[model samples]
Target: MGDVVEMTSELGFKYSILASGSTGNSFYLETPEKKILVDAGLSGKKITSLLAEIDRDPSDLDAILVTHEHKDHIHGVGVLARKYGMDIYANEKTWQIMDSKNMLGKVDNSQKHIFSRGKLLTFGDIDIESFGVSHDAINPQFYRFMKDGKSFVMLTDTGYVSDRMAGLIENADGYLIESNHDIEILRAGSYPWSTKQRILSDQGHLCNEDGADAMIRTIGNKTKKIYLGHLSKENNIKELAYMTMENQLARADFGVGTDFKIFVTSPDTATPLTDI
Candidate 1:
Protein backbone atom coordinates (compact mmCIF):
# COMPACT_ATOMS: atom_id res chain seq x y z
CA MET A 1 0.00 0.00 0.00
CA GLY A 2 2.80 2.41 0.82
CA ASP A 3 4.51 1.59 -2.44
CA VAL A 4 1.28 2.29 -4.30
CA VAL A 5 0.99 5.68 -2.66
CA GLU A 6 4.59 6.54 -3.34
CA MET A 7 4.35 5.59 -6.99
CA THR A 8 1.05 7.38 -7.46
CA SER A 9 2.37 10.57 -5.88
CA GLU A 10 5.16 10.65 -8.41
CA LEU A 11 2.82 10.49 -11.39
CA GLY A 12 0.78 13.16 -13.16
CA PHE A 13 -2.45 11.14 -13.72
CA LYS A 14 -4.70 9.41 -11.25
CA TYR A 15 -7.53 6.89 -11.53
CA SER A 16 -9.85 4.81 -9.41
CA ILE A 17 -12.17 1.93 -9.96
CA LEU A 18 -15.49 3.25 -8.75
CA ALA A 19 -17.15 -0.17 -9.02
CA SER A 20 -16.49 -3.31 -10.95
CA GLY A 21 -18.40 -6.56 -11.29
CA SER A 22 -21.68 -7.95 -12.58
CA THR A 23 -23.73 -5.48 -10.56
CA GLY A 24 -22.07 -2.36 -11.99
CA ASN A 25 -18.86 -1.05 -13.52
CA SER A 26 -17.40 2.43 -13.68
CA PHE A 27 -13.94 3.99 -13.69
CA TYR A 28 -12.76 7.51 -12.95
CA LEU A 29 -9.60 8.99 -14.45
CA GLU A 30 -8.08 12.40 -13.86
CA THR A 31 -5.24 14.09 -15.66
CA PRO A 32 -3.89 17.52 -14.82
CA GLU A 33 -6.25 19.09 -17.32
CA LYS A 34 -8.98 16.53 -17.84
CA LYS A 35 -11.47 14.45 -15.90
CA ILE A 36 -12.95 11.41 -17.63
CA LEU A 37 -15.36 8.65 -16.73
CA VAL A 38 -14.89 5.52 -18.76
CA ASP A 39 -18.31 4.10 -17.92
CA ALA A 40 -21.25 4.78 -15.58
CA GLY A 41 -22.79 1.43 -14.78
CA LEU A 42 -24.46 2.50 -11.56
CA SER A 43 -27.28 5.00 -11.13
CA GLY A 44 -26.68 8.67 -11.79
CA LYS A 45 -26.93 9.47 -8.08
CA LYS A 46 -24.65 6.59 -7.22
CA ILE A 47 -22.00 7.68 -9.72
CA THR A 48 -22.17 11.26 -8.53
CA SER A 49 -21.68 10.05 -4.99
CA LEU A 50 -18.77 7.88 -6.06
CA LEU A 51 -17.18 10.88 -7.75
CA ALA A 52 -17.66 12.92 -4.60
CA GLU A 53 -15.94 10.17 -2.61
CA ILE A 54 -12.77 10.96 -4.53
CA ASP A 55 -13.25 14.76 -4.37
CA ARG A 56 -14.56 15.06 -7.90
CA ASP A 57 -17.79 16.47 -9.35
CA PRO A 58 -19.88 15.12 -12.17
CA SER A 59 -20.21 18.49 -13.83
CA ASP A 60 -16.46 18.87 -13.97
CA LEU A 61 -15.97 15.83 -16.18
CA ASP A 62 -14.86 16.55 -19.71
CA ALA A 63 -16.36 13.44 -21.28
CA ILE A 64 -18.04 10.11 -20.60
CA LEU A 65 -16.72 7.32 -22.82
CA VAL A 66 -18.68 4.12 -23.45
CA THR A 67 -17.08 0.80 -24.25
CA HIS A 68 -20.21 -1.20 -25.03
CA GLU A 69 -23.98 -1.17 -24.62
CA HIS A 70 -24.31 -3.75 -21.85
CA LYS A 71 -26.57 -2.63 -19.02
CA ASP A 72 -23.80 -3.03 -16.48
CA HIS A 73 -21.67 -0.67 -18.60
CA ILE A 74 -24.15 1.99 -19.67
CA HIS A 75 -26.88 2.05 -17.05
CA GLY A 76 -26.12 5.58 -15.90
CA VAL A 77 -24.68 6.98 -19.11
CA GLY A 78 -27.79 8.82 -20.23
CA VAL A 79 -28.65 10.25 -16.84
CA LEU A 80 -25.10 11.42 -16.22
CA ALA A 81 -24.85 13.06 -19.59
CA ARG A 82 -28.28 14.68 -19.31
CA LYS A 83 -27.72 15.97 -15.82
CA TYR A 84 -24.18 17.17 -16.31
CA GLY A 85 -24.54 18.31 -19.91
CA MET A 86 -21.30 16.55 -20.75
CA ASP A 87 -20.24 15.03 -24.01
CA ILE A 88 -20.58 11.25 -24.41
CA TYR A 89 -18.44 9.35 -26.91
CA ALA A 90 -19.02 5.85 -28.25
CA ASN A 91 -18.76 3.89 -31.44
CA GLU A 92 -21.55 4.21 -34.02
CA LYS A 93 -22.64 0.62 -33.55
CA THR A 94 -22.82 1.04 -29.81
CA TRP A 95 -24.82 4.25 -30.22
CA GLN A 96 -27.17 2.52 -32.62
CA ILE A 97 -27.84 -0.30 -30.21
CA MET A 98 -28.16 2.04 -27.24
CA ASP A 99 -30.54 4.24 -29.20
CA SER A 100 -32.56 1.28 -30.41
CA LYS A 101 -32.93 0.01 -26.87
CA ASN A 102 -33.34 3.48 -25.38
CA MET A 103 -30.58 2.54 -22.97
CA LEU A 104 -29.22 6.05 -22.52
CA GLY A 105 -32.58 7.85 -22.36
CA LYS A 106 -32.68 11.17 -24.20
CA VAL A 107 -29.19 12.53 -24.75
CA ASP A 108 -29.13 15.81 -26.63
CA ASN A 109 -27.48 15.89 -30.03
CA SER A 110 -24.68 18.07 -28.70
CA GLN A 111 -23.90 15.56 -26.00
CA LYS A 112 -23.56 12.60 -28.35
CA HIS A 113 -20.21 12.09 -30.05
CA ILE A 114 -19.06 9.13 -32.12
CA PHE A 115 -15.58 7.84 -32.78
CA SER A 116 -14.60 5.12 -35.18
CA ARG A 117 -13.32 1.87 -33.73
CA GLY A 118 -9.51 1.57 -33.43
CA LYS A 119 -9.07 5.27 -34.14
CA LEU A 120 -7.26 7.69 -31.86
CA LEU A 121 -8.89 10.83 -30.50
CA THR A 122 -7.64 13.61 -28.31
CA PHE A 123 -9.49 14.82 -25.25
CA GLY A 124 -7.88 17.67 -23.42
CA ASP A 125 -4.32 16.50 -22.65
CA ILE A 126 -5.02 12.83 -23.15
CA ASP A 127 -4.94 10.67 -26.24
CA ILE A 128 -7.71 8.05 -26.24
CA GLU A 129 -8.02 5.02 -28.46
CA SER A 130 -10.55 2.20 -28.58
CA PHE A 131 -10.05 -1.33 -29.85
CA GLY A 132 -12.25 -4.34 -30.45
CA VAL A 133 -12.66 -6.93 -27.76
CA SER A 134 -14.47 -10.25 -27.91
CA HIS A 135 -17.67 -9.76 -25.95
CA ASP A 136 -21.37 -10.45 -26.36
CA ALA A 137 -22.49 -6.94 -27.21
CA ILE A 138 -22.84 -4.73 -30.20
CA ASN A 139 -19.30 -3.75 -31.12
CA PRO A 140 -17.84 -4.20 -27.66
CA GLN A 141 -14.52 -2.41 -27.12
CA PHE A 142 -12.13 -0.99 -24.52
CA TYR A 143 -9.88 2.04 -24.25
CA ARG A 144 -6.25 2.97 -23.74
CA PHE A 145 -5.45 6.46 -22.50
CA MET A 146 -2.03 7.98 -23.07
CA LYS A 147 -0.77 11.26 -21.71
CA ASP A 148 2.82 12.38 -21.76
CA GLY A 149 4.62 9.01 -21.78
CA LYS A 150 2.31 7.06 -19.50
CA SER A 151 -0.58 4.94 -20.69
CA PHE A 152 -3.47 3.33 -18.85
CA VAL A 153 -5.65 0.63 -20.36
CA MET A 154 -9.22 -0.01 -19.29
CA LEU A 155 -10.04 -3.50 -20.51
CA THR A 156 -12.85 -5.75 -19.34
CA ASP A 157 -15.77 -7.97 -20.46
CA THR A 158 -13.70 -9.63 -23.12
CA GLY A 159 -13.63 -13.43 -23.20
CA TYR A 160 -10.32 -13.75 -24.97
CA VAL A 161 -7.34 -11.53 -25.60
CA SER A 162 -5.94 -12.23 -29.03
CA ASP A 163 -2.34 -11.40 -29.79
CA ARG A 164 -3.47 -8.32 -31.67
CA MET A 165 -5.60 -7.14 -28.78
CA ALA A 166 -2.72 -7.66 -26.39
CA GLY A 167 -0.35 -5.77 -28.68
CA LEU A 168 -2.57 -2.74 -28.89
CA ILE A 169 -2.59 -2.30 -25.12
CA GLU A 170 0.91 -3.59 -24.47
CA ASN A 171 3.37 -1.66 -22.32
CA ALA A 172 0.70 0.45 -20.67
CA ASP A 173 1.75 1.89 -17.35
CA GLY A 174 -1.40 0.50 -15.75
CA TYR A 175 -4.33 -1.76 -16.62
CA LEU A 176 -7.79 -2.59 -15.33
CA ILE A 177 -8.74 -5.98 -16.75
CA GLU A 178 -11.43 -8.48 -15.91
CA SER A 179 -10.61 -11.63 -13.99
CA ASN A 180 -14.23 -12.61 -13.79
CA HIS A 181 -14.45 -16.24 -12.74
CA ASP A 182 -12.64 -19.38 -11.75
CA ILE A 183 -13.34 -22.09 -14.28
CA GLU A 184 -13.61 -24.78 -11.63
CA ILE A 185 -16.02 -22.68 -9.60
CA LEU A 186 -18.15 -21.80 -12.58
CA ARG A 187 -18.24 -25.36 -13.73
CA ALA A 188 -19.28 -26.53 -10.27
CA GLY A 189 -21.45 -23.60 -9.22
CA SER A 190 -25.22 -23.51 -9.61
CA TYR A 191 -25.58 -20.95 -12.38
CA PRO A 192 -27.56 -23.13 -14.80
CA TRP A 193 -25.52 -25.07 -17.33
CA SER A 194 -26.41 -22.80 -20.24
CA THR A 195 -25.38 -19.66 -18.44
CA LYS A 196 -22.14 -21.32 -17.54
CA GLN A 197 -21.58 -22.25 -21.16
CA ARG A 198 -22.20 -18.70 -22.27
CA ILE A 199 -19.70 -17.35 -19.78
CA LEU A 200 -17.19 -19.95 -20.92
CA SER A 201 -17.75 -19.13 -24.55
CA ASP A 202 -15.53 -17.11 -26.82
CA GLN A 203 -17.81 -14.08 -26.56
CA GLY A 204 -18.10 -14.37 -22.80
CA HIS A 205 -16.08 -12.97 -19.92
CA LEU A 206 -12.43 -13.87 -19.34
CA CYS A 207 -11.75 -16.23 -16.49
CA ASN A 208 -9.03 -15.66 -13.93
CA GLU A 209 -6.39 -17.72 -15.67
CA ASP A 210 -6.95 -16.08 -19.02
CA GLY A 211 -6.89 -12.65 -17.46
CA ALA A 212 -3.55 -13.42 -15.84
CA ASP A 213 -2.10 -14.64 -19.11
CA ALA A 214 -3.27 -11.46 -20.79
CA MET A 215 -1.41 -9.41 -18.24
CA ILE A 216 1.75 -11.51 -18.58
CA ARG A 217 1.77 -11.00 -22.32
CA THR A 218 1.29 -7.27 -22.00
CA ILE A 219 3.44 -6.29 -19.03
CA GLY A 220 6.61 -4.41 -19.83
CA ASN A 221 9.34 -2.50 -18.02
CA LYS A 222 7.08 0.52 -17.83
CA THR A 223 4.10 -1.42 -16.43
CA LYS A 224 3.76 -0.89 -12.72
CA LYS A 225 0.11 -1.21 -11.74
CA ILE A 226 -2.48 -3.86 -12.52
CA TYR A 227 -6.11 -3.86 -11.45
CA LEU A 228 -7.98 -7.20 -11.44
CA GLY A 229 -11.55 -6.16 -11.99
CA HIS A 230 -15.01 -7.56 -12.82
CA LEU A 231 -14.89 -10.58 -10.53
CA SER A 232 -17.88 -12.85 -10.21
CA LYS A 233 -19.41 -12.71 -6.76
CA GLU A 234 -20.55 -16.32 -7.00
CA ASN A 235 -17.76 -17.72 -9.12
CA ASN A 236 -14.66 -15.94 -7.88
CA ILE A 237 -13.00 -14.89 -4.66
CA LYS A 238 -11.06 -11.65 -4.49
CA GLU A 239 -8.09 -13.31 -2.86
CA LEU A 240 -8.20 -16.13 -5.36
CA ALA A 241 -8.12 -13.71 -8.27
CA TYR A 242 -5.25 -11.78 -6.76
CA MET A 243 -3.29 -14.95 -6.01
CA THR A 244 -3.90 -16.34 -9.46
CA MET A 245 -2.34 -13.23 -10.96
CA GLU A 246 0.47 -13.09 -8.44
CA ASN A 247 1.34 -16.75 -8.87
CA GLN A 248 1.25 -16.67 -12.65
CA LEU A 249 3.33 -13.52 -12.93
CA ALA A 250 5.79 -15.00 -10.46
CA ARG A 251 6.41 -17.97 -12.74
CA ALA A 252 7.21 -15.41 -15.44
CA ASP A 253 9.85 -13.82 -13.17
CA PHE A 254 7.74 -10.92 -11.94
CA GLY A 255 7.47 -10.11 -8.26
CA VAL A 256 4.13 -8.98 -6.87
CA GLY A 257 5.25 -6.02 -4.73
CA THR A 258 8.57 -5.43 -6.45
CA ASP A 259 7.99 -5.68 -10.20
CA PHE A 260 4.53 -4.10 -9.95
CA LYS A 261 1.58 -3.71 -7.61
CA ILE A 262 -1.81 -5.40 -7.92
CA PHE A 263 -5.21 -4.08 -6.92
CA VAL A 264 -8.42 -6.07 -6.77
CA THR A 265 -11.47 -3.92 -7.48
CA SER A 266 -14.80 -4.26 -5.71
CA PRO A 267 -18.37 -4.01 -6.87
CA ASP A 268 -19.58 -1.93 -3.93
CA THR A 269 -16.75 0.50 -3.20
CA ALA A 270 -14.06 2.61 -4.78
CA THR A 271 -10.44 1.52 -5.00
CA PRO A 272 -7.61 3.71 -3.80
CA LEU A 273 -6.76 6.45 -6.27
CA THR A 274 -3.65 5.35 -8.16
CA ASP A 275 -1.41 6.94 -10.73
CA ILE A 276 1.09 5.50 -13.21
Candidate 2:
Protein backbone atom coordinates (compact mmCIF):
# COMPACT_ATOMS: atom_id res chain seq x y z
CA MET A 1 0.00 0.00 0.00
CA GLY A 2 1.16 3.53 -0.78
CA ASP A 3 1.88 5.98 1.99
CA VAL A 4 -1.08 8.14 2.87
CA VAL A 5 -0.15 11.40 4.51
CA GLU A 6 -2.01 12.37 7.66
CA MET A 7 -4.41 15.24 7.14
CA THR A 8 -4.35 16.24 10.78
CA SER A 9 -1.13 17.53 12.29
CA GLU A 10 -1.94 16.82 15.92
CA LEU A 11 0.21 14.20 17.64
CA GLY A 12 -1.49 10.97 18.67
CA PHE A 13 -0.94 7.21 18.57
CA LYS A 14 0.95 5.97 15.51
CA TYR A 15 0.41 2.48 14.04
CA SER A 16 1.90 0.59 11.11
CA ILE A 17 1.44 -2.88 9.73
CA LEU A 18 4.74 -4.58 9.01
CA ALA A 19 2.60 -7.32 7.46
CA SER A 20 -0.99 -8.49 7.74
CA GLY A 21 -3.46 -11.06 6.38
CA SER A 22 -2.94 -14.82 5.73
CA THR A 23 0.67 -14.72 4.50
CA GLY A 24 1.80 -13.11 7.76
CA ASN A 25 0.64 -10.77 10.50
CA SER A 26 2.77 -8.14 12.21
CA PHE A 27 2.20 -4.59 13.41
CA TYR A 28 4.16 -1.77 14.96
CA LEU A 29 2.65 0.61 17.47
CA GLU A 30 4.40 3.77 18.56
CA THR A 31 3.39 5.85 21.56
CA PRO A 32 5.12 9.05 22.58
CA GLU A 33 7.60 7.20 24.77
CA LYS A 34 7.59 3.60 23.56
CA LYS A 35 7.88 1.69 20.32
CA ILE A 36 6.25 -1.71 20.38
CA LEU A 37 5.56 -4.63 18.00
CA VAL A 38 2.23 -6.38 18.21
CA ASP A 39 3.20 -9.57 16.32
CA ALA A 40 6.04 -11.09 14.30
CA GLY A 41 4.33 -13.34 11.78
CA LEU A 42 6.57 -12.29 8.94
CA SER A 43 10.16 -13.45 8.43
CA GLY A 44 13.02 -11.78 10.27
CA LYS A 45 14.42 -10.44 7.00
CA LYS A 46 11.08 -9.07 5.89
CA ILE A 47 10.46 -7.47 9.28
CA THR A 48 13.87 -5.84 9.18
CA SER A 49 13.25 -4.43 5.71
CA LEU A 50 9.83 -3.14 6.69
CA LEU A 51 11.32 -1.45 9.76
CA ALA A 52 14.00 0.12 7.61
CA GLU A 53 11.35 1.29 5.21
CA ILE A 54 9.86 3.28 8.07
CA ASP A 55 13.27 4.53 9.20
CA ARG A 56 13.40 2.21 12.19
CA ASP A 57 15.62 -0.68 13.27
CA PRO A 58 14.89 -3.95 15.05
CA SER A 59 16.79 -2.80 18.14
CA ASP A 60 14.45 0.15 18.48
CA LEU A 61 11.52 -2.01 19.58
CA ASP A 62 10.87 -2.01 23.33
CA ALA A 63 8.92 -5.26 23.25
CA ILE A 64 7.19 -7.79 21.03
CA LEU A 65 3.66 -8.72 22.03
CA VAL A 66 2.06 -11.88 20.67
CA THR A 67 -1.65 -12.53 20.28
CA HIS A 68 -1.45 -16.29 19.93
CA GLU A 69 0.84 -19.25 19.24
CA HIS A 70 -0.27 -19.65 15.64
CA LYS A 71 2.54 -19.94 13.13
CA ASP A 72 1.19 -16.96 11.22
CA HIS A 73 1.56 -14.88 14.39
CA ILE A 74 4.87 -16.13 15.72
CA HIS A 75 6.80 -16.91 12.53
CA GLY A 76 9.65 -14.54 13.29
CA VAL A 77 9.08 -13.75 16.94
CA GLY A 78 11.97 -15.88 18.15
CA VAL A 79 14.36 -14.64 15.51
CA LEU A 80 13.53 -11.00 16.02
CA ALA A 81 13.66 -11.21 19.80
CA ARG A 82 16.94 -13.13 19.79
CA LYS A 83 18.45 -10.69 17.34
CA TYR A 84 17.33 -7.57 19.15
CA GLY A 85 17.20 -8.90 22.70
CA MET A 86 13.62 -7.69 23.01
CA ASP A 87 11.02 -9.13 25.33
CA ILE A 88 8.02 -11.24 24.26
CA TYR A 89 4.79 -10.70 26.16
CA ALA A 90 1.65 -12.80 26.10
CA ASN A 91 -0.84 -14.53 28.39
CA GLU A 92 0.10 -17.53 30.52
CA LYS A 93 -1.73 -20.00 28.34
CA THR A 94 -0.05 -18.66 25.26
CA TRP A 95 3.34 -18.86 26.86
CA GLN A 96 2.65 -22.37 28.09
CA ILE A 97 1.58 -23.50 24.65
CA MET A 98 4.66 -21.98 23.07
CA ASP A 99 6.89 -23.56 25.68
CA SER A 100 5.27 -26.94 25.19
CA LYS A 101 5.91 -26.68 21.49
CA ASN A 102 9.47 -25.37 21.98
CA MET A 103 8.72 -22.22 19.99
CA LEU A 104 10.48 -19.60 22.03
CA GLY A 105 14.13 -18.55 21.72
CA LYS A 106 16.49 -17.82 24.57
CA VAL A 107 15.16 -14.87 26.54
CA ASP A 108 14.59 -13.77 30.09
CA ASN A 109 11.49 -15.34 31.62
CA SER A 110 10.83 -12.19 33.63
CA GLN A 111 10.54 -10.28 30.37
CA LYS A 112 7.80 -12.60 29.17
CA HIS A 113 5.11 -10.94 31.25
CA ILE A 114 2.02 -13.14 31.30
CA PHE A 115 -1.05 -11.01 30.72
CA SER A 116 -4.39 -11.84 32.27
CA ARG A 117 -7.73 -11.60 30.59
CA GLY A 118 -9.54 -8.31 31.24
CA LYS A 119 -6.55 -7.07 33.20
CA LEU A 120 -4.50 -4.04 32.27
CA LEU A 121 -0.72 -4.21 31.91
CA THR A 122 1.65 -1.31 31.60
CA PHE A 123 4.53 -1.53 29.10
CA GLY A 124 6.58 1.61 28.78
CA ASP A 125 4.17 4.42 27.93
CA ILE A 126 1.28 2.23 26.78
CA ASP A 127 -1.39 0.55 28.86
CA ILE A 128 -2.62 -2.66 27.21
CA GLU A 129 -5.89 -4.39 27.95
CA SER A 130 -6.18 -7.89 26.50
CA PHE A 131 -9.39 -9.92 26.31
CA GLY A 132 -10.33 -13.34 25.01
CA VAL A 133 -11.32 -13.55 21.36
CA SER A 134 -13.27 -16.37 19.71
CA HIS A 135 -10.54 -18.36 17.98
CA ASP A 136 -9.18 -21.89 18.02
CA ALA A 137 -6.15 -21.60 20.24
CA ILE A 138 -5.03 -22.34 23.77
CA ASN A 139 -5.75 -18.72 24.68
CA PRO A 140 -6.10 -16.18 21.92
CA GLN A 141 -6.67 -12.59 23.01
CA PHE A 142 -7.34 -9.36 21.20
CA TYR A 143 -5.77 -6.17 22.46
CA ARG A 144 -6.84 -2.65 23.31
CA PHE A 145 -4.08 -0.14 23.83
CA MET A 146 -4.30 3.26 25.47
CA LYS A 147 -1.65 5.93 25.50
CA ASP A 148 -1.59 9.69 25.64
CA GLY A 149 -5.37 9.94 25.91
CA LYS A 150 -5.85 8.00 22.68
CA SER A 151 -6.96 4.41 22.37
CA PHE A 152 -6.90 1.76 19.63
CA VAL A 153 -8.13 -1.81 19.43
CA MET A 154 -6.63 -4.65 17.40
CA LEU A 155 -8.87 -7.68 16.96
CA THR A 156 -8.24 -10.45 14.44
CA ASP A 157 -8.50 -14.24 14.19
CA THR A 158 -11.94 -13.95 15.70
CA GLY A 159 -14.89 -15.99 14.50
CA TYR A 160 -17.72 -14.07 16.15
CA VAL A 161 -18.01 -10.81 18.01
CA SER A 162 -19.13 -11.31 21.56
CA ASP A 163 -20.94 -8.49 23.37
CA ARG A 164 -17.96 -8.21 25.67
CA MET A 165 -15.54 -7.77 22.77
CA ALA A 166 -17.78 -5.17 21.18
CA GLY A 167 -17.91 -3.16 24.38
CA LEU A 168 -14.14 -3.26 24.67
CA ILE A 169 -13.60 -2.06 21.10
CA GLU A 170 -16.21 0.67 21.07
CA ASN A 171 -15.18 4.31 21.31
CA ALA A 172 -11.61 3.72 20.20
CA ASP A 173 -9.65 6.13 18.03
CA GLY A 174 -8.61 3.33 15.65
CA TYR A 175 -9.62 -0.26 14.96
CA LEU A 176 -7.71 -3.09 13.28
CA ILE A 177 -10.49 -5.62 12.92
CA GLU A 178 -10.67 -8.80 10.90
CA SER A 179 -12.66 -9.18 7.70
CA ASN A 180 -11.54 -12.72 7.03
CA HIS A 181 -13.92 -14.16 4.45
CA ASP A 182 -17.07 -13.99 2.38
CA ILE A 183 -19.37 -16.77 3.53
CA GLU A 184 -20.96 -17.43 0.18
CA ILE A 185 -17.64 -17.47 -1.59
CA LEU A 186 -16.17 -19.74 1.02
CA ARG A 187 -19.07 -22.15 0.76
CA ALA A 188 -18.89 -22.32 -3.02
CA GLY A 189 -15.13 -22.64 -3.14
CA SER A 190 -13.38 -26.01 -3.50
CA TYR A 191 -12.42 -26.82 0.04
CA PRO A 192 -13.04 -29.96 2.13
CA TRP A 193 -16.23 -30.02 4.13
CA SER A 194 -14.44 -30.29 7.46
CA THR A 195 -12.12 -27.45 6.57
CA LYS A 196 -15.01 -25.25 5.52
CA GLN A 197 -16.89 -26.12 8.68
CA ARG A 198 -13.90 -25.15 10.78
CA ILE A 199 -13.69 -21.84 8.95
CA LEU A 200 -17.38 -21.15 9.61
CA SER A 201 -17.42 -22.40 13.17
CA ASP A 202 -17.56 -20.13 16.21
CA GLN A 203 -13.85 -20.77 16.76
CA GLY A 204 -12.99 -19.88 13.17
CA HIS A 205 -12.39 -16.66 11.30
CA LEU A 206 -15.01 -13.91 10.99
CA CYS A 207 -16.90 -13.41 7.75
CA ASN A 208 -17.21 -10.08 5.99
CA GLU A 209 -20.80 -9.65 7.14
CA ASP A 210 -19.82 -10.44 10.72
CA GLY A 211 -17.07 -7.84 10.64
CA ALA A 212 -19.33 -5.18 9.09
CA ASP A 213 -22.00 -5.88 11.64
CA ALA A 214 -19.51 -5.57 14.48
CA MET A 215 -18.25 -2.27 13.10
CA ILE A 216 -21.76 -0.86 12.99
CA ARG A 217 -22.38 -1.95 16.54
CA THR A 218 -19.09 -0.89 18.10
CA ILE A 219 -17.82 2.16 16.20
CA GLY A 220 -18.26 5.48 17.96
CA ASN A 221 -17.76 9.16 17.21
CA LYS A 222 -14.18 8.92 18.39
CA THR A 223 -13.40 6.11 15.95
CA LYS A 224 -11.27 7.85 13.37
CA LYS A 225 -9.69 4.93 11.48
CA ILE A 226 -10.81 1.44 10.48
CA TYR A 227 -8.54 -1.15 8.85
CA LEU A 228 -9.93 -4.42 7.55
CA GLY A 229 -7.35 -7.14 8.15
CA HIS A 230 -6.75 -10.91 7.83
CA LEU A 231 -8.77 -11.20 4.62
CA SER A 232 -8.75 -14.60 2.92
CA LYS A 233 -6.99 -14.57 -0.43
CA GLU A 234 -9.33 -17.15 -1.91
CA ASN A 235 -12.67 -16.20 -0.40
CA ASN A 236 -12.45 -12.42 -0.34
CA ILE A 237 -11.25 -9.48 -2.40
CA LYS A 238 -10.03 -6.12 -1.18
CA GLU A 239 -12.61 -4.19 -3.20
CA LEU A 240 -15.43 -6.42 -2.00
CA ALA A 241 -14.47 -6.14 1.65
CA TYR A 242 -14.07 -2.38 1.39
CA MET A 243 -17.39 -1.96 -0.39
CA THR A 244 -19.19 -4.18 2.10
CA MET A 245 -17.88 -2.20 5.07
CA GLU A 246 -18.47 1.12 3.32
CA ASN A 247 -22.08 0.28 2.49
CA GLN A 248 -22.75 -1.03 5.96
CA LEU A 249 -21.28 2.05 7.62
CA ALA A 250 -23.33 4.24 5.28
CA ARG A 251 -26.52 2.63 6.54
CA ALA A 252 -25.33 3.49 10.04
CA ASP A 253 -24.95 7.18 9.00
CA PHE A 254 -21.18 7.08 8.83
CA GLY A 255 -19.50 7.99 5.56
CA VAL A 256 -16.19 6.38 4.78
CA GLY A 257 -13.22 8.74 4.25
CA THR A 258 -15.29 11.48 5.90
CA ASP A 259 -16.37 10.08 9.21
CA PHE A 260 -13.22 7.99 9.37
CA LYS A 261 -10.37 6.82 7.20
CA ILE A 262 -10.52 3.26 5.88
CA PHE A 263 -7.44 1.18 5.07
CA VAL A 264 -6.59 -2.39 3.98
CA THR A 265 -3.32 -4.09 4.94
CA SER A 266 -1.39 -6.62 2.86
CA PRO A 267 -0.45 -10.06 4.12
CA ASP A 268 3.06 -9.86 2.69
CA THR A 269 4.16 -6.23 2.90
CA ALA A 270 4.07 -3.30 5.27
CA THR A 271 1.28 -0.79 4.99
CA PRO A 272 1.77 2.93 5.37
CA LEU A 273 2.06 4.32 8.87
CA THR A 274 -1.25 5.70 10.15
CA ASP A 275 -1.42 8.29 12.91
CA ILE A 276 -4.55 9.11 14.83
- Winning model by lDDT: 1
Using alpha carbons, what is the TM-score of model 2? 0.93
lDDT of 2 by residue, 1-276 (tens): 999987754456778877778878988988767888988988899889988877788888888988999989998998888788888888888999898788876666666777777788987667899889988988898799887678989989988998978987788998888999998999999989898999899999988889988999899889888989999898889899888899888887886788798888788767777776
> What TM-score do all the candidates reach, one by one?
0.94, 0.93
lDDT (Cα, tens digit) per residue for candidate 1, span 116-155: 7999998877888989999889898899988879999988
- Point out where model 2 deviates above 4 Å: 1-11
How large an RMSD does model 1 have?
5.2
Error of 2 at 209 (Å): 0.8
lDDT of 1 at 118: 94
* Index of the highest-TM-score prediction: 1
* Model 1 clashes, total count: 0
List of clashing residue pairs for candidate 2:
20-267
